[model samples]
Target: MLKLKYYLSLIVWNLFVNTLGKSMFTPQSIRFLLYKMAGMRTASANIRSGCSFRGKNLVIEQGVFLNHNVFIDSWEKVLIQENTAIAFDVLICTSSHKIGGPFKRVGDSDRKPIVIGQGCWIGARATILPGVTIGDGCIIAAGSVVNKDCKAHTLYAGVPAKEIRPLENREVNANIK
Candidate 1:
């Protein structure tokens, strides 16, 4: 089937990238070039080592940056809008089990589209689940598991993350010590 082939190709490509491309890049430019060849939009972006993109329809828009150990289980279309930043160890997954099925299966689950809006920041080790739409300018805290839609200009934290507060300053000091 078409889906089967797609999955197979993804596996093969991931293996090749992990095995060969992992050790060959010293600078971010080299990694960006490799990502371009592998069907990622990497202009002004840094998708770090150990990152995984499993779906053919994974769309990383302009200025999107994914840091180290990022894992995207995008069986369907996972769209990271322009200027979004996914920090280290972040996992955005777009697949989930069909609980109504007679027997449980891994890939037999229904797939959903994950949309991370522009200028959003997903912190380290955060997990964005299937069917979640993160609004523009939203900030997901580190180690959080987001299972619902997050509003724009809001800061969300905790497991099954709830809204913590609104982003008052629009300026996250990246250089804060």
Candidate 2:
């Protein structure tokens, strides 16, 4: 069955590709090949070892580099556009539990997609919450917790991630290699 195959592939990826410490030394093409074989849509991506995700709702565009220990909990969908670089230990989640009395009692949770536009740079250890849309050429500061949508060509930082300043005349340099 389809579901059985999906689970088996997930197990293989986690065991063979994600857990091995030496998998980082493996060529990027092999890593991408394994991910694509597991049903993820990836193009020219360099996802380092120890990166973990569930399901097949991840779309990583061309020239995107995901550094080590990146965790994408894509219960919904996650779209990382071209030339984006997500740094180490970044957590991009697409699901969270609902708060309040009745919802908590019923174990209700919400799911929404996360979209990171082209030429964006997500700094180290940034936590992107559910339903966040980071615009093109934006720079997320290190250790920032982004709970809301971000604007293009700007820098965001801090706990809740406030816009620090607009990146004037620097959108051309925001493309990550």
Candidate 3:
């Protein structure tokens, strides 16, 4: 009965709040309230309309912004720290199927935490896979696939997201304030 109620409410939220574009006009406080009701741990974050998140293991810190159409599949914990901005159409997933085993044959899956440190920017259409820890002040370029841990104050781009360069202290500090 509890599972049924939870799923029903989640469906209602998707239909009324996420798909109906309510966040575009709804006050930020109301939006945060709705998300909190849906079991997300959110601070003073701004989540734009058309964004969708699943599970109760999601945390959005103060000043975090999730742009339009962002999808978070939080099978495990997903933590977005303060002052981070995730651009449109980004996908952050914390679950994936196992490979080459009996469990894989039976469609078994694994989950891990995704932690995005403070003051980072995840560009549009970037995909963050399970168990990825993105350090503070990093920039992930658009269309990148991040499958591993990232360093602090770095710029990462391309498929599978190679480190482009270490961001200068000036560049890193500029967006912090």
TM-score of each: 0.80, 0.84, 0.84
The residue-by-residue lDDT of candidate 2 on 26-106, one tens digit each, is 677677776666567788657887787765688889989999889998889999999999999999999887765853554
Model 1, residue 126: C-alpha shift (Å): 0.6
> Model 3's lDDT to the true fold?
0.86
> Where in model 2 is the C-alpha error above 4 Å?
1-22, 100-106, 169-177
Over 1-177, each residue of candidate 3 has an lDDT whose tens digit, in order, gives 999998897787676556543457776677777766655678854888778777668888999999888999887999999999999999999998776666446456889999999999999999999999999999999999999999999999999999999987565346775
Question: Considering TM-score, which of the candidate structures 1 and 2 is the better prediction for this target?
Answer: 2
Clash counts for all predictions? 0, 0, 0
Query: Which ten residues in a row are the worst by lDDT in model 3?
Result: 14-23
Better of 2 and 3 by lDDT: 3
Clashes of 3: 0
lDDT of 1 by residue, 1-177 (tens): 999998897766665455434543435677666666666544555666767666666788888888877888878888898999989889889988765545544445778889999999999999999999999999999999999999998999999899999886446687799
Position 102, candidate 2: lDDT: 59
Q: What's the C-alpha lDDT at position 8 in model 2?
A: 88
State the C-alpha lDDT per candidate. 0.80, 0.85, 0.86
